[model samples]
Structures are given as C-alpha cells and as structure tokens.
Target: MKISELSRRTGVPVASIKYFLRQELLPAGRATAATLAEYGDEHVQRLRLIKALTALGGLSIAATRNVLAAIDQADSSEGALGAVSYALPVPVAAQSAAGDEEEAEADATAGAEVAELLAALDWQAPGTSPHVQGLTSALKELRRLDARYAPGELAAYARLAESVARLDLERAAGVDDPVALAERAVIVFAICAPVFELLRRLAQEDQVRRRAAGDGAEAASPR
Candidate 1:
C-alpha cells in the first residue's frame, strides 16, 4: 500500500504520518521510488499504535519512542509490562532541600508504609518501580492530611488491585507478539482507566442513594 492509502485507511492525516515517519515513531515504508514508498500491514498497525499512545495515552513523542523501543526489545510478557509501566508517567512529590530533616522523615515513613502494604499483599514489584514510588508519594500526602487508610481498608484495595492485575495479565498472555502485547497494554490503560473510574463513581452514587432511602424508611417506621 502507498503512504496515502495507509493514511486514508488509518484516518491519520498525511502530514501527521510524515511527522511520525520523521520522528521514527513509525518505521519508514519500503522505498519504491525517490518520493514514493510502499507501506505494509505492520506499518499500519504501528501507526495506529502510535496514534493511540500519543492521542489517547497522552504520551509525549519522546515517551512514545521509549515505549516502542521497550516493546521492541521485550522478550516476554513481564518485560513488556515492565517497559509499559516505566513509560507511563507517575506523579512524584517534589523533593525538599538536603537539610530538610522533617521532609526526609515524612518520605521515609511514606516509603515504609508503601513497603508494608505491598509486603502484606505479597505483590512482587521492585521497590524502584514507578508505580510503587507514585503510590508511596500519594500515601505520604494522605498521611499528611490524616487520611491514610487503615490496614484493613488498604487490604481491601489491594484485593481489588490484584483482581485487575490478574485480568490484565490474562489478556496480555493471549497475544504472542511482545509488541502487540505492549500495544494492548497501552490501549487498555488509556481507554479503560477512565471507564473504570466512572463505573466506580456510579456505583458509589447508587449505594449512597440506597442507604439514604433505607435511612428514611427506618426513621418513618413507627416504633
């Protein structure tokens, strides 16, 4: 297929496709002429993946390149997953000055709490994982606000996380190609994260409405 055909089929603008080609986000098609090239199905797939990563996943060009490189180099499901995780941006708290002992203590406490939670859950991620560090940072803020979860509550959240992780791994295992698996992971996180949050909010609202109705009924019961 020609580049024009590739762009038309993928609904990606020709200029954007050219930009991707220049940036090496999408591999160059075969050179049939000085100005004409033939693209293949693989090129189409890669272009779509790039579009999803940048447009939906909100990754920058550099980040997308790193993610694609990781996917290309990954030899197994775990490796691909680790690459995706590393590529995904995680919010880290701003560090304090070197002499800020109080800030250092808070960070230490937060890291310890995160370690404890992960240990209790038996999750095997390395301490240096971006997700772990982000969670630790979040826990630090939660602690500062006196809103940290009790152990039991944290355990409940861990169980939910485990369930989601299991489903993700199960789906990823079906794709034999590491690159395709990484693409799937990118799409899943980009598209499903917001959907999951929406579902949770809807469920909470339903539960609250039910509880309010129950409370009203109980108060109306002539005791």
Candidate 2:
C-alpha cells in the first residue's frame, strides 16, 4: 500500500501522517523509490494506535512518543501497564506561601494521612508516584476546605479504588502481545477515567435526589 492508502485506511490526513513520520511516532514506510514508499498493515496499525494515543487518550505528541517507546521496549504486561499509567496526567500541587505555618501544617497532615491510608490498605506505592502526590495535594485542599473525610471513609474509597483497579487490570490479562496489551491499557485507563468520573457525578446527582426525597442512603452522612 502507498502512504495515501495508509492515510485513507486509517482516516488520518496525509499531512498528519507525514508529520508523524517526521516525528518518528509512526515508523517510516519501506522506501521503494526516491519519492515513494510502500506501507503495510503494520503502518496502518501504527497510525491507528498513534491516533488513539493522541486523540482518544489525550496524550501530547511527546507523551505519545514516550508511551510508544515504552510499548516498544516493554518486556511484560507490567511494563506496558506502567507505561500507560505514567502517561496519564495527574494533578499538580500548587505552591503555597513561604513560611506559612498553617499551610505547612495542613500539607504535613495530608501527607501523613495519605501514608497511613496507603499503609492500612497494604498498597505499596512509591512516595514519588504521581497518583500519590496528586492524592496528597487533593487531601490538602480538602482539609483546607474543611470538608475532610474521616479515615474510615477514605479507607472505604481506597478499597473501592483497589477493586476498580483489579477489574481494569483483568481486562488486559493474558494478552501476550506488547502492543495489544499497551493499547488495552491505554483504552482502559484513558477512556475509562473520564467515564468513571462522569458516572460518579451522575451518581452524586441521584444521591442528591434521594436525600431530597428522604430516600435511601440519607445524604452521605459523612461516614
């Protein structure tokens, strides 16, 4: 197949495909002549994957490159999983006023709470994990808002997260191909994240309605 055929089959524009080729996100097609190249099914698959990573997965080209590199170099499913996990963006903690004792105290408290939560759940994530850092920042903001959740409530949420993660991993299990596993991981992580958030928001609306009607669950009750 020619590049035009590859572009048509993938529904990616020729210019964008050329850009990807220049960026090395899509591997170069086999050179057949001075101004022409022959593409194969592999090129089609690669272009589709690139589109998914950039469009559906919401990854920047640089991040997409890293993810592709990770996929190319991955030796196992865990490696693929890690690649996708790291590619997803997390919230960054905003800087606080220097020498503010109250703000510093809140941060320390949030960090310790997160540490305890992780320990109690037996979830051994690195302190440097972006997810951990994001959670810590979230807890800090939550405390600042005076809407801090009880430890048991947080633990319950963590358990639910653990279960969700297990289910997410199970979706990709037994796939031996690195590219296939990476694609599944990207789809499950990137697409399902927004789905989960939207579902939670919808559930929150139902909870509000239920509480207004004096129905089930009774207004969250704050644990």
Best by lDDT: 2
Tell me the spans in candidate 1 whose CA falls farther than 4 Å from its real position.
Answer: 91-99, 215-223
lDDT, each prediction? 0.82, 0.86
* Clashes within 3 Å, all models in order: 0, 0
The window of 10 residues in a row where model 2 has the poorest summed lDDT is 90-99
Please provide, for model 2 over 164-192, each residue's C-alpha lDDT reduced to its tens digit, 9 standing for 90 to 100: 89988899989887777777877898888
Score candidate 1 by TM-score against the native: 0.90
lDDT, residue 103, candidate 1: 76
lDDT of 2: 0.86
Ten consecutive residues with minimal summed lDDT in candidate 1?
Answer: 214-223
